[model samples]
Target: MIGKWLDIGPTTQIEPGSARTLPVFGGEEIAVFHTVRGEFYALVNKCPHKAGPLSQGIIHGDSVTCPLHNWRISLRTGEALGEDKGCTPTIPLKIDGGRIFLLREAVVA
Candidate 1:
């Protein structure tokens, strides 16, 4: 568990059923999303293609559509769907008492 607690503002920053980008650890961005099931997920904000910000992407169910080139990445597995190649790193997020926390390092599988 290379997990580290990353402070990404308050829990309210990520609206329910929505995703947002957070800047931490030397300006590295992380995309935080709250599922309709009330579960939280976090991933690298940069897309594998052209380094697009995945946080600005749209959330459709358990997938996120990269805003840069319409590439879709799974919020759960960080695997690019459709015609995309390569996978983005994912950080595990655990929120406790209104403070959003994430692992300092991402795990790419």
Candidate 2:
């Protein structure tokens, strides 16, 4: 029902070092992050450990620490950081004209 990319509004929607949730119609919920370094990334909202909501996790560098168990997940690669195991899926994302766009194929069918 949408185009090749999902336009998720302006970059200002998410503040630095924070994240927001985007519900996907045919896939898992996505967590969009605005790092303090002015970079943006999108990953599955679910944590690899215990399926915790990654959106509620604390953002530090390019990683988010799972609030459920302090499991750190890399925003860029979605891999668990440090000794943590497992990984969450990362949705391809980009920014243009101050708006965030997610790869349509990686998001929903």
lDDT of 1 at 65: 83
The local distance difference test score of each candidate is: 0.78, 0.92
For 1-109, candidate 1 gives per-residue lDDT tens digits of 4445656678777787788876665668777888777778888888888788887777888888878889898888989898678798888878889888876555222
Q: State the lDDT at 107 in candidate 1.
A: 27
Looking at model 1, report the run of 10 residues with the lowest lDDT sum. Answer: 100-109
Best by the lDDT measure: 2
Off by over 4 Å in 2: none
Residue 29, candidate 2: C-alpha displacement in angstroms: 0.9
Q: For all candidates, what are the clash counts?
A: 1, 0
Off by over 4 Å in 1: 1-4, 7-10, 105-109
Residues forming the 10-long window of minimal summed lDDT in candidate 2: 1-10
- Local accuracy of candidate 2 as per-residue lDDT tens digits, 52-74: 99999999999999999999999
Top model by TM-score, which number? 2
Clashing pairs in 2: none
